[model samples]
Target: MKKKRILSLCMGLFFSTLLYSQMVGIKTNVVMDALRIINVGAEIGLSKKMTLDLYANYNPWEYKELQMMKMLALQPELRYWFCDRFNGHFVGAHIHGGVYQAAGIDMPFGIWPDLKDHRFKGHFYGMGVSYGYQWILSKRWNLEGNIGFGYARVKYEQFECKTCGDKVGEGHKNYVGPTKAALSLIYVF
Candidate 1:
Protein backbone atom coordinates (compact mmCIF):
# COMPACT_ATOMS: atom_id res chain seq x y z
CA MET A 1 0.00 0.00 0.00
CA LYS A 2 2.81 2.44 0.78
CA LYS A 3 4.59 1.66 -2.53
CA LYS A 4 1.39 2.31 -4.46
CA ARG A 5 0.95 5.64 -2.73
CA ILE A 6 4.54 6.65 -3.52
CA LEU A 7 4.16 5.82 -7.19
CA SER A 8 0.93 7.77 -7.35
CA LEU A 9 2.54 10.77 -5.71
CA CYS A 10 5.44 10.68 -8.16
CA MET A 11 3.13 10.54 -11.13
CA GLY A 12 1.12 13.41 -9.78
CA LEU A 13 4.25 15.50 -9.35
CA PHE A 14 5.32 14.81 -12.94
CA PHE A 15 1.94 15.86 -14.28
CA SER A 16 1.90 19.03 -12.24
CA THR A 17 5.37 19.94 -13.37
CA LEU A 18 4.40 19.59 -16.99
CA LEU A 19 1.36 21.76 -16.47
CA TYR A 20 3.29 24.50 -14.73
CA SER A 21 6.09 24.54 -17.27
CA GLN A 22 3.89 25.75 -20.07
CA MET A 23 5.35 28.93 -21.52
CA VAL A 24 4.60 31.68 -24.03
CA GLY A 25 7.33 33.50 -25.90
CA ILE A 26 7.91 36.10 -28.57
CA LYS A 27 10.98 36.38 -30.79
CA THR A 28 12.39 38.08 -33.83
CA ASN A 29 15.03 37.40 -36.41
CA VAL A 30 16.91 40.65 -36.67
CA VAL A 31 18.83 39.71 -39.79
CA MET A 32 16.04 40.29 -42.25
CA ASP A 33 16.04 44.07 -42.35
CA ALA A 34 13.26 45.00 -44.73
CA LEU A 35 10.44 42.98 -43.22
CA ARG A 36 9.75 43.60 -39.55
CA ILE A 37 9.79 39.92 -38.72
CA ILE A 38 8.33 38.81 -35.44
CA ASN A 39 7.34 35.35 -34.36
CA VAL A 40 5.05 34.63 -31.44
CA GLY A 41 4.82 31.18 -29.94
CA ALA A 42 3.47 29.01 -27.17
CA GLU A 43 5.46 26.14 -25.78
CA ILE A 44 3.82 23.15 -24.19
CA GLY A 45 5.81 20.54 -22.42
CA LEU A 46 4.67 17.06 -23.43
CA SER A 47 7.33 15.23 -21.45
CA LYS A 48 10.54 16.07 -19.65
CA LYS A 49 12.33 15.80 -22.96
CA MET A 50 9.74 16.95 -25.47
CA THR A 51 7.90 20.14 -26.34
CA LEU A 52 5.41 21.40 -28.92
CA ASP A 53 5.69 24.93 -30.24
CA LEU A 54 3.44 26.89 -32.55
CA TYR A 55 4.47 30.21 -33.97
CA ALA A 56 3.63 32.56 -36.78
CA ASN A 57 5.62 35.24 -38.62
CA TYR A 58 3.96 38.23 -40.18
CA ASN A 59 5.31 41.08 -42.26
CA PRO A 60 2.56 43.56 -43.04
CA TRP A 61 4.78 45.88 -45.04
CA GLU A 62 4.34 46.80 -48.62
CA TYR A 63 7.07 46.27 -51.21
CA LYS A 64 8.58 49.43 -52.58
CA GLU A 65 11.62 49.50 -54.86
CA LEU A 66 13.89 49.15 -51.84
CA GLN A 67 11.80 47.28 -49.26
CA MET A 68 12.44 43.81 -50.64
CA MET A 69 11.00 41.32 -48.22
CA LYS A 70 7.40 40.47 -47.18
CA MET A 71 5.69 37.31 -46.07
CA LEU A 72 3.19 35.65 -43.72
CA ALA A 73 4.08 32.26 -42.39
CA LEU A 74 2.97 29.76 -39.75
CA GLN A 75 5.27 27.17 -38.26
CA PRO A 76 4.43 24.32 -35.91
CA GLU A 77 7.14 22.12 -34.51
CA LEU A 78 7.63 19.12 -32.25
CA ARG A 79 11.00 19.19 -30.59
CA TYR A 80 12.98 16.70 -28.58
CA TRP A 81 15.41 18.26 -26.19
CA PHE A 82 18.46 16.28 -25.35
CA CYS A 83 18.75 17.52 -21.82
CA ASP A 84 15.51 19.28 -20.86
CA ARG A 85 12.75 21.50 -22.11
CA PHE A 86 13.59 25.11 -23.14
CA ASN A 87 17.30 24.49 -22.69
CA GLY A 88 20.28 22.76 -24.32
CA HIS A 89 20.28 21.03 -27.69
CA PHE A 90 17.10 20.24 -29.55
CA VAL A 91 16.11 18.42 -32.70
CA GLY A 92 12.79 19.27 -34.23
CA ALA A 93 10.52 18.48 -37.11
CA HIS A 94 8.62 21.47 -38.41
CA ILE A 95 6.03 22.15 -41.06
CA HIS A 96 5.68 25.70 -42.36
CA GLY A 97 3.49 27.39 -44.94
CA GLY A 98 3.20 30.98 -46.08
CA VAL A 99 2.53 33.50 -48.81
CA TYR A 100 5.17 35.97 -50.00
CA GLN A 101 5.72 38.80 -52.45
CA ALA A 102 9.03 40.41 -53.19
CA ALA A 103 11.62 41.40 -55.76
CA GLY A 104 15.39 40.68 -55.75
CA ILE A 105 15.21 39.37 -52.19
CA ASP A 106 17.99 36.95 -51.25
CA MET A 107 17.13 34.07 -48.98
CA PRO A 108 19.99 33.09 -46.69
CA PHE A 109 21.76 29.76 -46.38
CA GLY A 110 21.59 27.40 -49.34
CA ILE A 111 18.31 28.92 -50.51
CA TRP A 112 20.00 31.90 -52.10
CA PRO A 113 19.64 33.55 -55.48
CA ASP A 114 15.88 33.22 -55.13
CA LEU A 115 14.40 35.35 -57.90
CA LYS A 116 17.64 37.11 -58.61
CA ASP A 117 17.32 40.63 -60.01
CA HIS A 118 13.65 39.94 -60.58
CA ARG A 119 10.35 40.10 -58.73
CA PHE A 120 7.91 37.39 -57.77
CA LYS A 121 4.51 37.57 -56.19
CA GLY A 122 3.46 34.17 -55.01
CA HIS A 123 2.97 31.60 -52.27
CA PHE A 124 5.31 28.96 -50.83
CA TYR A 125 5.06 26.08 -48.34
CA GLY A 126 7.44 23.47 -46.98
CA MET A 127 8.49 21.10 -44.23
CA GLY A 128 11.86 20.41 -42.69
CA VAL A 129 13.95 18.94 -39.87
CA SER A 130 16.06 21.27 -37.81
CA TYR A 131 18.83 21.26 -35.22
CA GLY A 132 19.00 24.06 -32.71
CA TYR A 133 20.74 25.10 -29.57
CA GLN A 134 19.15 27.37 -27.02
CA TRP A 135 21.18 29.39 -24.59
CA ILE A 136 19.65 30.73 -21.42
CA LEU A 137 20.60 34.37 -21.22
CA SER A 138 18.64 35.13 -18.09
CA LYS A 139 15.71 33.74 -16.14
CA ARG A 140 13.24 34.92 -18.76
CA TRP A 141 15.39 35.29 -21.85
CA ASN A 142 16.83 32.79 -24.28
CA LEU A 143 18.81 33.06 -27.49
CA GLU A 144 18.54 30.30 -30.03
CA GLY A 145 20.09 29.47 -33.37
CA ASN A 146 18.45 27.02 -35.73
CA ILE A 147 19.11 25.69 -39.22
CA GLY A 148 16.89 23.44 -41.29
CA PHE A 149 16.76 21.69 -44.66
CA GLY A 150 13.72 20.84 -46.76
CA TYR A 151 11.74 21.57 -49.89
CA ALA A 152 9.44 24.42 -50.86
CA ARG A 153 6.84 24.36 -53.59
CA VAL A 154 6.61 27.91 -54.79
CA LYS A 155 4.06 29.22 -57.23
CA TYR A 156 4.98 32.67 -58.45
CA GLU A 157 4.43 35.21 -61.17
CA GLN A 158 7.14 37.58 -62.30
CA PHE A 159 6.58 41.29 -62.15
CA GLU A 160 8.31 44.00 -64.16
CA CYS A 161 8.64 46.08 -61.07
CA LYS A 162 7.50 45.95 -57.45
CA THR A 163 5.73 49.31 -57.13
CA CYS A 164 4.35 49.34 -60.64
CA GLY A 165 2.93 45.82 -60.32
CA ASP A 166 3.29 44.92 -63.96
CA LYS A 167 3.30 41.21 -64.69
CA VAL A 168 6.20 39.97 -66.83
CA GLY A 169 6.00 36.14 -66.43
CA GLU A 170 4.37 33.38 -64.40
CA GLY A 171 5.33 29.89 -63.30
CA HIS A 172 5.79 27.56 -60.32
CA LYS A 173 8.96 26.04 -58.88
CA ASN A 174 9.77 23.07 -56.68
CA TYR A 175 12.74 24.11 -54.59
CA VAL A 176 14.61 21.48 -52.64
CA GLY A 177 17.06 23.13 -50.28
CA PRO A 178 17.32 24.94 -47.00
CA THR A 179 13.85 26.00 -45.94
CA LYS A 180 14.15 27.14 -42.31
CA ALA A 181 16.90 29.31 -40.91
CA ALA A 182 16.79 31.70 -38.02
CA LEU A 183 18.94 33.38 -35.45
CA SER A 184 16.33 34.21 -32.89
CA LEU A 185 16.30 36.53 -29.93
CA ILE A 186 13.67 35.11 -27.64
CA TYR A 187 11.80 36.46 -24.65
CA VAL A 188 10.69 33.47 -22.63
CA PHE A 189 8.10 33.48 -19.92
Candidate 2:
Protein backbone atom coordinates (compact mmCIF):
# COMPACT_ATOMS: atom_id res chain seq x y z
CA MET A 1 0.00 0.00 0.00
CA LYS A 2 2.75 2.41 0.94
CA LYS A 3 4.65 1.46 -2.20
CA LYS A 4 1.66 2.29 -4.36
CA ARG A 5 1.23 5.67 -2.68
CA ILE A 6 4.87 6.52 -3.21
CA LEU A 7 4.78 5.48 -6.87
CA SER A 8 1.65 7.52 -7.46
CA LEU A 9 3.20 10.53 -5.80
CA CYS A 10 6.36 10.22 -7.86
CA MET A 11 4.38 9.88 -11.07
CA GLY A 12 2.22 12.83 -10.15
CA LEU A 13 5.30 14.98 -9.58
CA PHE A 14 6.91 13.85 -12.80
CA PHE A 15 3.81 14.38 -14.91
CA SER A 16 2.94 17.66 -13.23
CA THR A 17 6.22 19.12 -14.36
CA LEU A 18 5.35 18.49 -17.98
CA LEU A 19 2.20 18.88 -20.05
CA TYR A 20 1.53 15.29 -21.02
CA SER A 21 -1.55 13.41 -22.12
CA GLN A 22 -3.03 11.47 -19.26
CA MET A 23 -6.24 9.75 -18.23
CA VAL A 24 -7.75 7.45 -15.60
CA GLY A 25 -10.19 4.58 -15.74
CA ILE A 26 -11.57 1.47 -14.06
CA LYS A 27 -11.41 -2.13 -15.33
CA THR A 28 -13.35 -5.30 -14.71
CA ASN A 29 -12.65 -8.90 -15.60
CA VAL A 30 -14.48 -12.15 -15.07
CA VAL A 31 -11.83 -14.63 -16.30
CA MET A 32 -8.96 -13.44 -14.10
CA ASP A 33 -8.35 -16.51 -11.94
CA ALA A 34 -9.25 -19.73 -13.65
CA LEU A 35 -12.70 -18.25 -14.25
CA ARG A 36 -13.14 -18.14 -10.47
CA ILE A 37 -12.31 -14.46 -10.11
CA ILE A 38 -14.09 -11.21 -10.79
CA ASN A 39 -11.79 -8.19 -10.58
CA VAL A 40 -12.59 -4.47 -10.45
CA GLY A 41 -9.67 -2.07 -10.48
CA ALA A 42 -8.48 1.39 -11.46
CA GLU A 43 -5.53 2.73 -13.43
CA ILE A 44 -3.80 6.05 -14.19
CA GLY A 45 -1.67 7.21 -17.06
CA LEU A 46 1.28 9.33 -15.97
CA SER A 47 1.93 10.32 -19.56
CA LYS A 48 1.24 9.20 -23.07
CA LYS A 49 4.04 6.73 -22.60
CA MET A 50 3.80 5.61 -18.99
CA THR A 51 1.14 4.22 -16.66
CA LEU A 52 0.78 3.35 -12.98
CA ASP A 53 -1.90 1.05 -11.69
CA LEU A 54 -3.24 -0.30 -8.39
CA TYR A 55 -6.02 -2.81 -8.03
CA ALA A 56 -7.42 -5.66 -5.99
CA ASN A 57 -9.25 -8.91 -6.67
CA TYR A 58 -11.59 -11.32 -4.92
CA ASN A 59 -10.67 -14.90 -5.79
CA PRO A 60 -12.91 -17.81 -4.87
CA TRP A 61 -11.39 -21.13 -3.89
CA GLU A 62 -13.58 -23.89 -2.51
CA TYR A 63 -11.39 -25.87 -0.13
CA LYS A 64 -11.47 -24.08 3.20
CA GLU A 65 -13.19 -21.58 5.49
CA LEU A 66 -11.57 -18.69 3.67
CA GLN A 67 -13.04 -19.57 0.30
CA MET A 68 -12.31 -16.17 -1.12
CA MET A 69 -8.86 -14.60 -1.40
CA LYS A 70 -8.30 -10.87 -1.62
CA MET A 71 -5.18 -9.28 -3.09
CA LEU A 72 -3.69 -5.79 -3.56
CA ALA A 73 -1.28 -5.24 -6.48
CA LEU A 74 0.66 -2.17 -7.54
CA GLN A 75 2.25 -1.84 -10.98
CA PRO A 76 4.34 0.87 -12.55
CA GLU A 77 4.80 0.40 -16.29
CA LEU A 78 6.08 2.12 -19.40
CA ARG A 79 4.07 2.12 -22.61
CA TYR A 80 4.68 3.23 -26.18
CA TRP A 81 1.87 4.60 -28.28
CA PHE A 82 1.99 2.90 -31.65
CA CYS A 83 -0.65 5.16 -33.11
CA ASP A 84 -2.08 8.62 -32.54
CA ARG A 85 -5.59 7.46 -31.66
CA PHE A 86 -4.46 5.24 -28.78
CA ASN A 87 -5.66 2.30 -30.83
CA GLY A 88 -2.49 0.32 -31.52
CA HIS A 89 -0.20 0.23 -28.49
CA PHE A 90 2.72 -1.67 -26.99
CA VAL A 91 3.41 -2.01 -23.27
CA GLY A 92 6.88 -2.89 -22.19
CA ALA A 93 7.61 -5.81 -19.94
CA HIS A 94 6.44 -4.59 -16.52
CA ILE A 95 7.03 -5.72 -12.96
CA HIS A 96 3.90 -6.24 -10.84
CA GLY A 97 3.89 -7.94 -7.45
CA GLY A 98 2.02 -7.76 -4.17
CA VAL A 99 0.60 -9.45 -1.10
CA TYR A 100 -2.37 -11.82 -0.75
CA GLN A 101 -3.74 -14.66 1.38
CA ALA A 102 -6.03 -17.65 1.00
CA ALA A 103 -9.17 -18.11 3.10
CA GLY A 104 -11.35 -20.86 4.73
CA ILE A 105 -8.91 -23.76 5.04
CA ASP A 106 -7.50 -24.72 8.45
CA MET A 107 -4.77 -26.88 6.99
CA PRO A 108 -2.35 -25.92 4.27
CA PHE A 109 -0.95 -29.34 3.82
CA GLY A 110 -2.35 -31.68 1.18
CA ILE A 111 -5.27 -34.02 1.93
CA TRP A 112 -5.07 -34.44 5.68
CA PRO A 113 -3.12 -37.53 6.46
CA ASP A 114 -4.75 -39.92 8.95
CA LEU A 115 -4.48 -37.40 11.79
CA LYS A 116 -7.56 -36.71 13.89
CA ASP A 117 -6.26 -33.97 16.20
CA HIS A 118 -3.99 -31.88 13.99
CA ARG A 119 -4.49 -28.92 11.67
CA PHE A 120 -2.39 -26.60 9.48
CA LYS A 121 -2.33 -23.25 7.65
CA GLY A 122 -1.21 -22.31 4.15
CA HIS A 123 0.00 -18.77 3.36
CA PHE A 124 1.87 -17.40 0.35
CA TYR A 125 3.73 -14.52 -1.39
CA GLY A 126 3.94 -13.92 -5.15
CA MET A 127 5.70 -11.80 -7.79
CA GLY A 128 5.84 -11.75 -11.61
CA VAL A 129 5.76 -9.85 -14.93
CA SER A 130 3.45 -9.57 -17.96
CA TYR A 131 3.39 -8.45 -21.58
CA GLY A 132 0.33 -7.20 -23.49
CA TYR A 133 -1.51 -4.56 -25.48
CA GLN A 134 -4.00 -1.75 -24.83
CA TRP A 135 -6.70 -0.16 -26.93
CA ILE A 136 -8.06 3.19 -25.83
CA LEU A 137 -11.69 3.82 -26.58
CA SER A 138 -11.76 7.33 -25.19
CA LYS A 139 -9.98 9.58 -22.73
CA ARG A 140 -11.38 7.73 -19.72
CA TRP A 141 -12.57 4.43 -21.17
CA ASN A 142 -10.17 1.90 -22.61
CA LEU A 143 -10.07 -1.83 -23.15
CA GLU A 144 -6.83 -3.66 -22.40
CA GLY A 145 -5.87 -7.18 -23.43
CA ASN A 146 -2.75 -8.74 -21.90
CA ILE A 147 -1.23 -12.03 -20.74
CA GLY A 148 0.38 -11.86 -17.29
CA PHE A 149 2.66 -14.52 -15.83
CA GLY A 150 4.04 -14.72 -12.31
CA TYR A 151 5.00 -17.04 -9.47
CA ALA A 152 3.64 -17.71 -6.01
CA ARG A 153 5.32 -19.46 -3.09
CA VAL A 154 3.13 -20.92 -0.37
CA LYS A 155 4.12 -21.73 3.22
CA TYR A 156 2.47 -24.69 4.85
CA GLU A 157 2.99 -25.43 8.54
CA GLN A 158 1.57 -28.12 10.82
CA PHE A 159 -0.22 -27.65 14.15
CA GLU A 160 -0.82 -29.48 17.43
CA CYS A 161 -2.48 -32.89 17.35
CA LYS A 162 -2.11 -36.24 19.01
CA THR A 163 -3.88 -38.58 16.58
CA CYS A 164 -2.30 -36.82 13.61
CA GLY A 165 -1.08 -40.18 12.33
CA ASP A 166 1.37 -39.89 9.47
CA LYS A 167 -1.09 -37.88 7.39
CA VAL A 168 -1.45 -34.76 9.55
CA GLY A 169 1.90 -34.87 11.29
CA GLU A 170 3.91 -31.75 12.11
CA GLY A 171 6.34 -30.07 9.72
CA HIS A 172 6.37 -27.67 6.74
CA LYS A 173 5.51 -27.96 3.05
CA ASN A 174 6.59 -25.16 0.76
CA TYR A 175 4.99 -24.88 -2.67
CA VAL A 176 6.33 -22.69 -5.45
CA GLY A 177 4.59 -22.54 -8.81
CA PRO A 178 3.54 -20.30 -11.65
CA THR A 179 0.98 -17.78 -10.48
CA LYS A 180 -1.12 -18.13 -13.64
CA ALA A 181 -2.04 -15.94 -16.59
CA ALA A 182 -4.22 -12.86 -16.33
CA LEU A 183 -6.59 -11.90 -19.14
CA SER A 184 -8.14 -8.64 -17.91
CA LEU A 185 -9.55 -5.28 -18.88
CA ILE A 186 -8.86 -1.83 -17.46
CA TYR A 187 -10.68 1.49 -17.20
CA VAL A 188 -8.33 4.49 -16.95
CA PHE A 189 -9.50 7.48 -15.03
TM-scores, all models, native as reference: 0.73, 0.52
Candidate 2 stretches with Cα past 4 Å from truth are 1-21, 33-38, 60-87, 92-122, 137-140, 158-180
The TM-score obtained by model 1 is 0.73
* Model 1: residue 187 alpha-carbon error in angstroms: 3.3
Quote the positional error of residue 124 for candidate 2 in Å. 2.9
Writing each residue's lDDT as its tens digit, candidate 2 over 1-189 gives 775785577556545533443665556654664555645554556566555544455444434432434444444444454553234655444444444433333344653342233444444455555555667667656666655555555455444433132434334333343343444555453
TM-score of 2: 0.52
lDDT accuracy of residue 20 in candidate 2: 45
Q: To one decimal, what is the Cα RMSD in angstroms of model 2 from the true structure? A: 7.2
Error of model 2, residue 9, in angstroms: 13
